[model samples]
Target: MKKLYLLLVAVLAIGTATMAQSKKALQTAVIKTPTVQCDMCKKRIEAFLDKEDGVASAVVDYKRKTTKVSFYTDRTNIENIKTAIANVGYDADDVTANEETYNRLPKCCKKPEDGGGMKKQ
Candidate 1:
């Protein structure tokens, strides 16, 4: 009985330690987007970032036109995060989305100059 109790305590301690080490917290940063006008834009940006390896969480504020992203610094950095956002047809910070990617956005998502009838950035 004594041996079993010690073994259980040891197992629990190890599990706790492993859990703590696996979870890395990072500071949050906000990225501004000029094309964030509606729910579709928010969903598209959030979904894309959520699939990235280093991103811990992403929240888009349409009214404020900013994305609050929490990412693991070891796995990714702010530049990568911004690039990922830009790849999905949204401008992040000072980096503009690639022209091809921006052109591929849905009609409503396309910027005004693209002839899709959306507002100009």
Candidate 2:
């Protein structure tokens, strides 16, 4: 019947649309940086990621000196996110901190090699 044919076509179209809309989800990398002695690092890192375009959420574990991020696959990617964090003076997995940004960290937040010697950055 024509009605059955139309319904089948509509269903196929919808299936295609749904598949196109479902962007691939990636289990992106985690970054571990020195969180130093307080909540400042956590606040700064989380706030930074919150404003980034692709980031869904960021969780900073101060005790472990690690940050776990969940992000969209389409709008942005891991490298861009890592660069954003590095721009703020924190080290992301693959991105190193710029000297200028690194030096700008608070005394307590400074990495061990920088002389503040609190811990790794």
Candidate 3:
């Protein structure tokens, strides 16, 4: 009985240590998207980012032209997140958007440099 009790205690201690090691804190980043022109741009970027691995949430403010992203650092990093954003036709900080993808964006979502893409309506 004593041996069994000691084995159970050891198992529990190991389990607790494993659980603690796996628990990672969510990190947040605010990335600038100077080309984000309107509501559509905001929604598109936020929705795409939310679907990425390790991303907990993403919110884009059209007025501010910034995206606030929360993600688990263990599964991904800031550079990966930014690259994902750029892949979806939106620039994240110093990362430039993919030209082919950016060209395919809706007229209102494109940057002014790409032929005056902002729509007032």
Candidate 4:
């Protein structure tokens, strides 16, 4: 009985350590997409970020103008994610969209400042 108890404790300790380390390695960040105006913008950003290195997944909510991204800290970071979004032609947090990519985006995805994009609700 004592041997079984010790084994159980050892297993639990290993599980707890594994969970803690994985939690640190994986992180989720909510980034504001100030220029995200419609479904097209959401799809574009999500699709682009989904293929970025270390990004586990990306969810963009155009209505909220926010993007929630899951990534491995050891492989990438928040700054890289922001830049990835910018490269896709949408602003991420304080990072502005890449001007060339922005110009190439569809009319519905462009910022309202450009007299394009959907009207904000």
Candidate 5:
């Protein structure tokens, strides 16, 4: 009887604490990624964002040149997310690619003007 009583108290306390904490706002944004050239670009950007804080998911559609990102507003914002993409050597909407990081990317990942693109079969 005593154990049962204690368990009930603990559960109530935990519930109250959980209820008192407000839910974080989640937002989704689609950022244009015109410079993404192929599957490699998609994989690189998606993998990089997957480890970023507040980012829940990043879906890159290379063919369409867009990235849909779902993230927690309290933890991070759109600008930060764009910068993260730039850090991985790709352009994220108005956020241009980081020059140094862009230079380090493989030939296949560089912009077409820089001679990077899928070879014609």
Candidate 6:
């Protein structure tokens, strides 16, 4: 019975540790995306961020030019999230979009400074 009690104590301790490790807090951050111009841009960024491993959800507001991202802090950090946004052809805070990706965006999605007309494509 002594051995059994010890086993039970070990099991409980292990279970508590596992639970604590898995209980990473979810965090949300708002990043400005100055270049996002239309619904298409919003959809693209949201879809891209949503597919990233740590991201829980992503919402882009074109009028305000911002993206709100919910993510697991244990799995990812804000810089990585911003880089992911840049990877999707949009600027996130100080991270610049990848040049090739930015160039490939539809003209309607590109910023006027990049020679993409703001007028309807």
The number of the candidate with the highest TM-score is 5
lDDT of 3 by residue, 1-113 (tens): 99999999999999998877656557889999888888888888888988899999898997898889999888988999999999999888999999999989988787787
Pairs in clash, predicted candidate 6: none
> What TM-score does each of the candidates earn?
0.74, 0.71, 0.79, 0.80, 0.82, 0.79
**Candidates by TM-score, descending order:** 5, 4, 3, 6, 1, 2
Model 2, span 10-105: residue lDDT tens:
999999887777555534557776534357777878898999987988888867878889888888888888888888788777578766987888
* CA RMSD per model (angstroms): 3.3, 4.3, 2.6, 3.1, 3.0, 3.1
Scored against the true structure, residue 13 in model 5 reaches a CA lDDT of 97
By lDDT, the best candidate is: 5
Tens digits of per-residue lDDT for model 6, 1-121: 9999999999999999888876656888999999999889988998888789989989999999999998888899999999999998888999999999999999989989777745843
Q: All candidates' lDDT scores?
A: 0.85, 0.77, 0.87, 0.90, 0.92, 0.89
- Weakest ten-residue segment in model 5 by summed lDDT: 17-26
Q: Which stretches of candidate 3 lie over 4 Å from their true place?
A: 1-23
Preferred candidate (lDDT higher): 2 or 6: 6
For candidate 5, write residues 53-74 as lDDT tens digits. Answer: 9999999998899999999888
Which stretches of candidate 5 lie above 4 Å from their native place? 1-24
Off by over 4 Å in 4: 1-20, 119-121
| Residues 50-89 of candidate 1: C-alpha lDDT, one tens digit per residue | 9998899999987798999999887899999999999998
The clash number for model 6 is 0
Candidate 4 accuracy as lDDT: 0.90
Backbone clashes, each candidate: 0, 0, 0, 0, 0, 0
